[model samples]
Target: MKNEPLAYRMRPKTIDEVISQAHLVGPKAIIRRMVDTKRLSSMIFYGPPGIGKTSIAQAIAGSTQYKFRQLNAVTNTKKDMQLVVEEAKMSGQVILLLDEIHRLDKAKQDFLLPHLESGKIVLIGATTSNPYHAINPAIRSRTQIFELYPLEEDDIITALKRALADSENGLAEYNPEVSDEAIHHFAMASYGDVRSALNALELAVLSAEQNDDKRQVTLEDAKVCIQKNTFQHDKDGDQHYDVMSAFQKSIRGSDVDAALHYLARLIEAGDLPTIARRLLVISYEDIGLASPGAAARTLSAIEASERLGFPEARIPLSQAVIELCLSPKSNSAITAIDQALSDIRNGKAGLVPKHLKDGHYQGAKELGNAIGYKYPHNYENSYVEQQYLPDTLKNKQYYEPKLTSKSEQKFAEIYNNLKSNKK
Candidate 1:
């Protein structure tokens, strides 16, 4: 018992002790109501690992006084099922805890179905995968599915504090005193996997030498136990947008160091897709015609990132980030589009001129479409005076070229020439 992990020792013995999932185990909750009346049926507890699914199952068995037996689909066989069923028949009913229930073979499922229907066995199937998508429909249909969410930082912190105080089952034997930073680190860095946090806490307490009165667990001690210091990043939250904003602005400002810094931060957060997406936007929005080839080069990098993924994906992402940061910047394309959008939105737009309208359809000539249209290809330098917009919008200008770099200047020269030729 002393050799057992702190997480195993700290398993909530009663539903009330289960801190993370109040909706499932609180007063008048589904599990509570069923357990109080001993009217529990087959259930599937689904969520990510180390989030108290197993603990809740054990808590139910204890409270209901049902014969509890645990098995894994990975190692257990059909014969094992037959034995448990026979014992349940002799001694009333059994509560069977099936781990990785998604992997339950057809033979075992077939044997368990009738037993479940007859109330001889209460099957508690535990799976990390979503039961709806991963579990067989027959199994899902028979079980009440309760989803377990990842434990919040406060809940994990409270659990850790409890473990430190409890002499009977926790780390109290070591007379450990953990720093607040250490405790907080465990709470957040564990990423809602309470078992891993508790295990790390246990190691920190056991390994640290006593400092005068108690084993002082420092932040470094905690980090050593957990292996990595997690930089809190909410990919779907404000921080994600903040970092992205910084990443793009740094590149636009031509601050390569800052851009690379933000890129590194995002990579450590494990959001290559976000970084890739932001980089692609920068290629066009910031680099634009100033470096006309930057967009294509950045796209190639993104494609490589999509294929490689992660640590390797970072290579292409870094290359693109560097290129975009160094390239001359422009927003002419985006500004041009925004101006056109503003015109359309505020009713500045007009219909295509009669001469400019498509006239290839049947009887189009009768309506006078393209009657006076000037064929530009037939004229010198492919130049011809033409009315492309409606009579009300003649000579309206939306794109004014900003030629800063050689590449942009080339486009500006062509635009100027066309404007000069237009009479």
Candidate 2:
């Protein structure tokens, strides 16, 4: 126990002690309610690393009288699980904290399903991957899924303060003097990872130069202990998708600063592909027709980003993001297309007009294809009125032009004029 890492040693002993994740372990939360009722059910907690998935599992185990067992889905074999089953048989019930439960093989899953159903083994599967996406549906269907968010800076600070004052399973015995700056550095630099913060604090305390028989941990010491600041930006994690969503929404909402902030986050994650793709989508989908020039510029920026690659690529990307955020927003184009698609999907489409059908085929003029097709280019002002849509949708209006920008205003003028001419 003395040799154990500070994070493991200081793991929350009960749900009350668990830091952050108030939504899960708070007094009025569902997990807390279940615990109070002593009617614990199988659950899977999914989130990014160091956000208390295992701590919550351990805390849940500590809150109950059930024999607790920990295993890794990948490292532990079916035989190891059999031993756990045997223990469950003798002990009546067991709270099994299966780490990386997403990786559980079919054999182990099959063996455990009956026990889970019998209430002999209450599973608390912990995984960093989204359970709905990574876990087998068979096991997933049997468990309630909960998401754990990254710890807040204040939460990390609270954990640090607790560790500093704790004599047992903590660094209180060292009598280390940690500055507020150092504490804040540990909290913020860890990026909501409590385990990383605690481990770094422990290292800073133990390795600091002794001052007046006490080790004084400075901000520099904290920085040295935690060599690199790691942000919670897994490209495949929930936070990544959330950031991407916020990025697009911020641009759509015309919040330039917020849009750039999310852009910077994506850039930091080195997700040029996602950033490039999302920006292109925003240009055409949200800003379409409102500022066609901006959409064209966005495409150019994406091309530049792809050619230049990151670091230098961020310049064009930043310009594009700012332009998009400040540009007039309109979803008219996407809305129009989607409305048209919905009509077609719902069987609103009828046979194409004979005049509109392909006349370049070998049928020649006898088939009557394009027999009366009016060529607009040969008419006055390159304008001609003819049946274009299918007969069923001849009067079906899809493109409702919004008077949001100068360009779209012109489009609306031309569209309304054509409608009047058709009448």
Candidate 3:
């Protein structure tokens, strides 16, 4: 315990001491409710690293008198789980914190399922990977899933100050002088990872030159300790999808600043392909009919981005994102197609009208195909009102133009005119 890192040593002994994640451990929260009622169940905690997944598990265990054990799913063998099981048998119940639970192999999972069912092990599984996608279904089905959020800057600062004041498990014994600038640097540079911030604070304090009896830590010391910023982006993780969703949503919601912000994050990740595809989809799906030309321009921008690649590609993408954010939005086209698809899927489709059927065959007239088909080209304005849909669906209407922009308003007028003529 004396040689353990500051982060491990400063682990909260109770739920109340855990920093941030009030949503989970708050008094009225579900986990706290479970603790209060002593109705513990197997659950999985998932999010980015250094976000109190293990700490929350420990706190929950500490809140109860049950035996607590910790193990890594990857590093620990099945035999390690057996040891916990043996202890559970003796103690009646054990709270087991399994780290990297997404990597739990089938063998270990098979061994744990029966115990999980028997209520002998109240498993608290923690993983940076999303449990739904990464964990085996057998284990996932038997556990409640909760997502942990990153610690805010204030939360990190609060934890850091607490660590400095904690003498027993923290750095209060050093009596080092830490500047506010240094603390701010640690809070910002670590990017919501309190563990990284605390360890860096420890490094700065331990390695700094002593000013008589006190070592004064500075922003320069904080910078050297945390050499690289942890921005917390995983290409295959939830953050990637989250950013992509926000990017399109911002554009649809017509917030240029927000759209650009998410675009910048995607650009920073160098995800040109995903950006290009999402932009193309947004052009038609969100801005359809209202600004048809914008969709064409977005296509050109995507082509330019693909040809130019990243860095330079960001220029075109940024321009396109700005234009899209400002573009008038409509989803009429997508809505119309989806409605038609739904009807077809639900067996609403009927036989094609005989007059609209192909009449090029030699025996077409005998079968009544195209017998009464009046060519619209021969009529005034290349328009004629006649039944095009099958007799059963002759009254079906799908495309209802959302008169959002001038272009869509014009389309709506024409559509209404044709519908009137049909009646």
Candidate 4:
């Protein structure tokens, strides 16, 4: 037991024993009902790391009389899935727990699709990615998706207390006294990750024992332990949000140096590849034609990042960030879309004009749907004046394209033509 991993030995064996995730494990939860009635469905648990997804699955297996088979999708293949299915055929009731199911390729995922629909095996998938986007739609549609939130700070504190008090696997031998300040520090650094919190606690206690002077774990001890241990960077947590905010604001403010710094921070912090791609989208939608090349360069950076992971990828992300920051900024396009959405949401959405609704020019000219609309392509300059907006917003100037060398010329010509037509 001394050589065993702390994560393994501390695994909860019962639902009551499991920590956090009350929304799913509470008395009246759908999962609890299924376990009580022995009628569990194929379900997917979606959440960040160390949030008790595996614990919940194991508890469900223990509660029901089902035969449990576990596999990691990162390493398992179709062959392993086939083997599990074969065993399930002869079992009483089968619960197939697939960890990191999003890591499974489309082909392997498809293997379980038919089996899930036919109710041959109760499939339980655990994933860190958004199931709606990560899992194949066919597979996602077949399973009941349940989102598991990250562990709360209070829950992490509770878990730390339990670990300290429990004699079987806790710090009973060392008799280390843990301070409240130390606990608070651990909880904050854990970032809603239970496993990380527990690991930090175990390490801090172990370090205190080695020192021989004081057997008490202090706030300093916990901080030292955390700094020494591998810092697990969660891309969806606070750091992710903070860095992205900084990056976006830097670009908006046209601070190239600041933007590059934030970009480097995210790269070093292990942000997801897709997040970098999303920033590229903001560059185009917010900056638009002000700097035509900004969006294209950002896209190229995304592709490069995807192809070359990590250290190699950081270069492209830095390049994109700098380029976007230096580009002339404009948000008229974003403002236009946002205003339109707000109007729709506020119930002020007006109808499409009658003339635009039906082709009056092709048939009944007096029907009013398409009576006065002009075709822009049919004109000499391939531009025409038309009332594209609702009557109330007919003259509203939403998109004021920035006056820049790249876009000013084209917009000037178009604006003059449209203004003359309106007169």
Worst 10 residues of 1 by lDDT: 229-238
TM-scores for every candidate against the unseen true structure: 0.63, 0.94, 0.89, 0.61
Local distance difference test scores for all models: 0.88, 0.90, 0.90, 0.77
**Ten-residue region with minimum lDDT total, candidate 3:** 226-235
Preferred candidate (lDDT higher): 1 or 2: 2
> Model 4: clashing residue pairs?
354-369, 355-369, 355-370
Per-residue lDDT tens digits of candidate 4, residues 302-336?
A: 88888998889877877777777777776766776
Model 2, residue 383: distance off in Å is 0.7
Best by TM-score: 2
Estimate, for each residue in 1-423, the C-alpha lDDT of model 1 and write its tens digit: 388999999998877788879889888999999988889899999876789989999999888878899999769999998888998999998999999998998888998899999989999999876677778998889999998888999999999999999999998878898999999999988878899899999989988988787999999998889966444466754457767889899999999999999999899998877777888889999889899899999999999988998889989988999899889888999998898888889997777888888899988899988788889899988878776767666777777677778999898898888777675
Candidate 1 stretches with Cα past 4 Å from truth are 229-423
- Using lDDT as the yardstick, the better of models 1 and 3 is 3
Please give, for residues 15-87, the per-residue lDDT of candidate 3 as tens digits. Answer: 8888888888987999989888888999999999988898898888888777889999999999999999999
Encode model 2's per-residue lDDT on 1-423: one tens digit a residue: 269899999998888898889898898999998877879999999988898988888888788756789999999999999999999889787899999898898999999999899988899999988887889999988999998888999999999999999999898888889999999999888988899999999988988888788889998899989866477788877778889999999999999999999999999888999999999999999999999998889999999999999899999999999999999988999999999999989988899888888889788578878889899999999999987988788888889998889999999999999999988
How much lDDT does candidate 2 score? 0.90
